[model samples]
Target: MRHQDERPEAPWAATNRPPMGWNSWDSYGTTVTEAEVLANARFLAGHDEGVLAAAGWDTVVVDIQWYEPTARPGGYNDDAPVLFDDHGFLQPVPARFPSSAGGRGFAPLASAVHDLGLRFGLHLMRGIARRAVEADLPVPGTPYRTGEIADTSSTCPWNSDCYGLRHDHPGAQAWLDAMVDHVVGWGVDFLKVDDMLAPYHRDAVEALSLAVRRAEQRHGRRVVVSLSPGTELSLAHLEHLREHADLWRVSDDLWDRWPDVEAQLGRMARWAPHSGPAGWADADMLPLGRIGVRAERGEPRHSLLTTDERRALLSLWCLARSPLFVGGDLPTSDAATVADLAHPGLLEVAHRSGGGRELLREGPTGAETAVWGAATPDGATRWVGVFSTAAEARRVRVPAAAAGLPGAPDVVVDVWSGERVPLASAGPATGGDTVLDVEVPAHGVRLLRLGTRAHSGTPGPEEHTWQG
Candidate 1:
C-alpha cells in the first residue's frame, strides 16, 4: 500500500458521506442484463418525477457476475458458476450483452449510462480476478503472471465461486491493483466488491481498499469503492472500510418486511455516527415499486412491498442513512409507487443531510422509533414513527419531553397527511407534562414530523386534541 501522505487526497477526504443510488442485485439478482441496465438508465434520466435522482440516488449500479456463461445440460452454480475469458477479465457474456461482444468489458454499456448523464457501477469479488489467474494471464508491468493463486485457502463461506486474495503473497497486491486498473479503465465510476466482509477477510479487505486508492491515483479520476453484504462486517472492519470505501453495507440483503426493517434499522443506530458527507453505511437496496421477483416456479411477480410497507421501507431507509438503491423493473412499475419514492421532501431527507441519529423511546402504549436526520445545508428533520405493535388499537400517551424537545413541539406535522397538527400554543405551552393520547392501530405506525414553530407558525388545535 502506498503511504497515505504520498497519495493524492481521497475523493471523499474533502467530504465524508455516502453515495446515493440504485443497485440491481437486491431485487433483480443475476438476471440483470446490459439491456435492462440501459433501460433503467434511460428511465431514470428521462423521468422528471425525480424517482431516480431525487433521493440521493444518482448512480445506477449493476451488481454481480458480468461474465459469459456456457450452457450446461444440467443447472448452473448457485454462487454464480461461470467462466471468464482469455484476457483474465470478466467480460459481458456475448449472448446477454451484444454491445460487449468483441472481448471488451462493460465499457460500451457504461458509456451509454454516462451518455444518459448518470454514473455506472460494477460488482466484483476478492482474489486473483479468478478467471484471469486460471488462464495464467501476465500482469501488465511485471513478468509476474497474474495466474498465480495466492491463497485458495480462504474462500467466502457462503459464496463458493472465488477464494480470497492473499494480501501477504508476493504479487497479490499487484494482482488487485491490476484488476482495479482494468475496471477503472472501463469508465466504471463505482465498484461494489463482494465477500470482503462475509468471509471476514480483514487482510484482503484492507488490501482491496489500498488497491482502490492506488487505482484512483493511476487513473487520475474518482472511482468510488463500495463494500457489500453487511452480515459479517464488524464495527472494527466497518470503521476501516469507511476510511477507504465511499460506502459500505451495514446489513445483508434487506427486503420489504417490517420486522426485517426494524432489525436492520436497529443495527444502523450504532452505525449512524459513522455517516458523513462521503462515507455512508448502506442498508442494502430499496425493494419498492414493481419488484420483479421469481416465485417457486419461473413466473415473476410484481413488487413485494405493499403501499404501506413501501412507505415504511422508505422511512426506515431515510432513518438508517442507507443509500437508496432502487431495485425493481422500472419500466413496469405503477405510477403511484414511482411517485411515492420520488417525494422530494422525503428524498431530500434520505439523501443530502438526512444522515443523523435515531432515537427510540418506549411508552406505556408502544415504542416510538424516532429517526432525527439533518436536511440539506442547515436544517434537521425528524421522523417519529409510532407503532402500536399490539393486537388491538393502542392509545399511547405522548409526553412533551419524550419527543426530544424542551416543552411541546411547536409544530407537529403528520408525515402521511402532510398537515400541520399543532402540539403547542404561543409562549411556553407546558413546562410540565403535556400528555397526548395517541391511538395507533394494530401493527400500524403514525409517522409525524417534529419541528419548531416556522417563524410565524402557530400551533394547531389537533396538537393538543385527544383523538378519541
Candidate 2:
C-alpha cells in the first residue's frame, strides 16, 4: 500500500506511469480486422509468464478509422463511408469487426480484451464525424442534431472524416458527452483524440476532456486522454494539458527511420522536464519489429532501422518517460524486438523514475550524442540516457562534473544488458575531470544507471545483447 505523499497527485492519478500498449496503425493501418487485434492482444497479455504485462506494457489501442467499413491499407480513403448509430455516436465497422454487428459496437471486442487483463483503447479524431452530421442524427439524451453542433468550416486538413465542432453550441458538449458515454459503456478505458495538437485546438481539446470527465463521473470508470500529431505543441499550453490529458504526443507520427528517431531527442528533451505523475509527453509509438505489413506509409517489411537503431528507439522512449505504445505486430515481430519490449530495467526508468532532462547535445548535426539524466522515484540514484545522433560511429567523452554525472559512480549498470558498465578510464583525454567515454554507433543509445544502488526488489535485467 502506498503512503499518501507517495501517491500520485494528479486528479486522475490512477494512471501515473506512461500508458504502454500496442497500437494497430503501424502494422495494419486503418484496415486491421478484429482477429488481428485479438491476436496482438493475446501476445501482449503474455500468458507466457506475463512478461510484457509485468513490464507495464498493458494497453491495446485500435487506431484511427475503425468506423470506416471499407477502410484500406496505404492511406485513409478520402470521404470514407463511416458507420454511426442513430445517436450520432460512431460504431465499429461490422465488416472488419464482426462482433460489432447487430448494433453491439465494440462491446464484444472490449470484453475479450478485458478478459485478457488489458485496457482497451480507441482512436478517434476530434469533433463530429461529417457523415453523422450529414445524417443529422440526434445526440443521445439531447434534443440537438449532429449537424447543429458541427462547424463545417473547420475541417481536418489531412482527413475528410470529421468537421470541427462549435464548442459554444450547447449541442457540442452534449454530442461529446454522448459519444464518451457510448464508448465508456463499451469498456473503452483509453481515448486517443487526434488532429487537435498540430495547430493546438484549445476549444476542442477542453470539450473532449470535459466530456470524458463527465462520463467518468457518471459511469465510475476512468478514461485516459491522449492528444496527437504534435506538429508544434507549445510549452505555454503545459498547464492546460495537465488539467485534461494523461499524455500527449510531443512529436509527429514516428516511424522506423533514423531521422524520425533522431528528431525526437530534441523534442523529448524539451518535453521531458514537464513529465511526471501529472502527465507525460509522448514521443510516439515504437515502430520496431515487423512493421509496414499494411502500414499507411510503407510497404510490407520488418522495421527499416538496424539492431542498434531499434534498441535506440526504445531506449530514448524509456529515457523520456514517454508513453510506450508499440507499432508492430507482436506475434510476428522479430525475437529481438519482442525481448526488448519486456526489459524491466529499461521500463523501470520510464515507469518509476523521476522526470528526465537533457544535459548536453554535443557536436554538429548528424555527428553527435546527447546526454539526458533522470533519477529514481526515491531520488537517491540517477539514470542517464546517452544518445548517438551521428551519421557514423564515434566515442563520446562524458565529463562527470561538466555533464552532471557522478565522478565515481557507486554503480555503473547498463540498462539494456543489465550488466555493469566498466569505467576503465574516468576522464577526457586531458584528464582534467572524471569522464566515461562510450562508443555509440550512428543513431544508437546507451542507457546507464549510476550513483547509488538500483531499486530494491526490482526484477532482473530484460537480457539485451546490444552494446555501446
Candidate 3:
C-alpha cells in the first residue's frame, strides 16, 4: 500500500528535522552513571560556545541497561533486580541515579536537561520485564497479571530481560499504556525501543505505537518513538514503520570502521525514499572522538576512522537526512573533533535541506563512486556530495543536470573549505554538459553548494576560502 493510503497524515508532524543528540552507548556502554550523564549534558549546554550547542545538538540520550542495578561496563546482569514500581514500569537505578530515589523516577534528571535547553531520552527493551512476569505483577488499571499478557515464546535474541507482549490479550495493551504513562510522566522527550524492529515484530510495534499515541493524547506531550537495530527490515515494511515510528534505525550498530561506513551508501539509497520530516531513516550513531571508554565491543581509544573518513560519513548522512546521534564522550573530545562536528555547511544540509536523492553510482561492482544531491529549504541552492568508495583515490564528475541545478551553475563553493571552485567552462557548454570534477581520496567525500550566481554583495570567492 502507498504511504498515504496506510496513514491518513504524518503522525509525527511535530518532528521536522532529523533528531540530533549524544547517546551514551559508545562512550560509557551499559555502565553510564548519573554523574557522567550530567557531565555530558553540561558540556552540551555549556556557555563556552561548545560545538554541540553551536551545531544545534539538543537531545541527551541515556542508552540501554539504565534500569539494571548490577549493570557493569562490559556486561549486564540480567538476573539482577531491576528498579521498577509495583505497576511493572521500569525506573532508573537509584544507586546510580540518586535523584530517582523516593519514587521520583527520571523527572529530576529530565528537568535538569530541560533547564539546560535540551531534550531528554531513554532506551527501552521490547516488552514486559521478565522479573515482572515472574512475580506476576498486576497490570495497571486491570486485574490481569503480567504473565497473562506476556508472550513466553517471544524473547529478545540478545537480551534476557524481557518477553514480548501477547497482542491477543487485552491486558497487554493496558500494560504498555501504563508503561508509557509512567515514562511520559517522567518527561521523556524520546524513547528508543530495541529488539523490536530487527526481526520486524509487527504486533509489538503496533501495540507500542498505539500505547505511545494514547499517552500523547492523555498527557499532551510529544515523544519521538524510535525503533532500533534495523538490520533485517525490507522495503515492504516502510509504510508500517512510517505509520508507527518517528525514527527507525536503517542499519545495525554502525561502528568506527570503513567497511561499515561504506556499506551504508546502498542502505541509505534504498531507504531514502521513505525518509521525510515525519520519519527518519537512522544511520546509527557517529563513533568519533573518545569512544569505547567503557564499552562492551572494544577497548578504550579514539575512533580508528581517519579525519577524511569521518567527513565522508557525516557528508553522506547529511545528504541522506539521517538522524545524527554522536556516540562520543563529549567532555573528553579534542578541539579538532569538536570543530569537525560543528561544520556549519554540513549541519545546514542535514537540518535545512529537502528532497535528498542519490544522483549517480558508477564504476565496478564493489568499487563504485556515488553522488548525492539535495535542494536547500528555500530551493535557491543545491548541495551536492561526491563520495569515493574505492580502495584508492578516484576522480568523480557530477553533471549539472544530474545535480538538479538549473543550467550550468555560475558559482560552486566547497562546503567544507568555503573556496569557490572555478567552473571548467564559463558559460553554457556547446557540445557536452558542464560537469564538476573533484578528486576524492579513498573513502573520502567532497561536498559543494551550487548556485546560479553568487549572492548580491557576497564576499568574493577568495574571501571565504578556508586555509585548512
Per-residue lDDT of 1-468 in model 2, one digit per residue for the tens? 112232224332543467788999999998988999999999988746788886677889999999988888888788888888887688898889999999998999999999999999999998888888999888777788888999999988889999999999998988888888889899998999999898899898888887887777777767888899888889999988887777898887888888998898888888988876677888998898898888898888899999889888787777777888998988888888787777767776766566578888878887877888877654456777788877777787777755566466777788777777766564346376667667777778778888666432253464221111
lDDT of 3 by residue, 105-168 (tens): 9999999999988889999999988898988888878989997989989988878888899999
Candidates arranged by TM-score, highest first? 2, 3, 1
Model 2, CA-based lDDT: 0.81
Best by TM-score: 2
Question: Better model by lDDT, 1 or 2?
Answer: 2
RMSD values, in order shown? 6.3, 4.6, 4.9
Worst lDDT run of 10 residues, candidate 3, spans 459-468
**In candidate 1, which residue ranges exceed 4 Å CA deviation?**
1-17, 49-51, 68-83, 129-131, 293-299, 352-355, 363-383, 387-395, 424-431, 435-444, 452-468
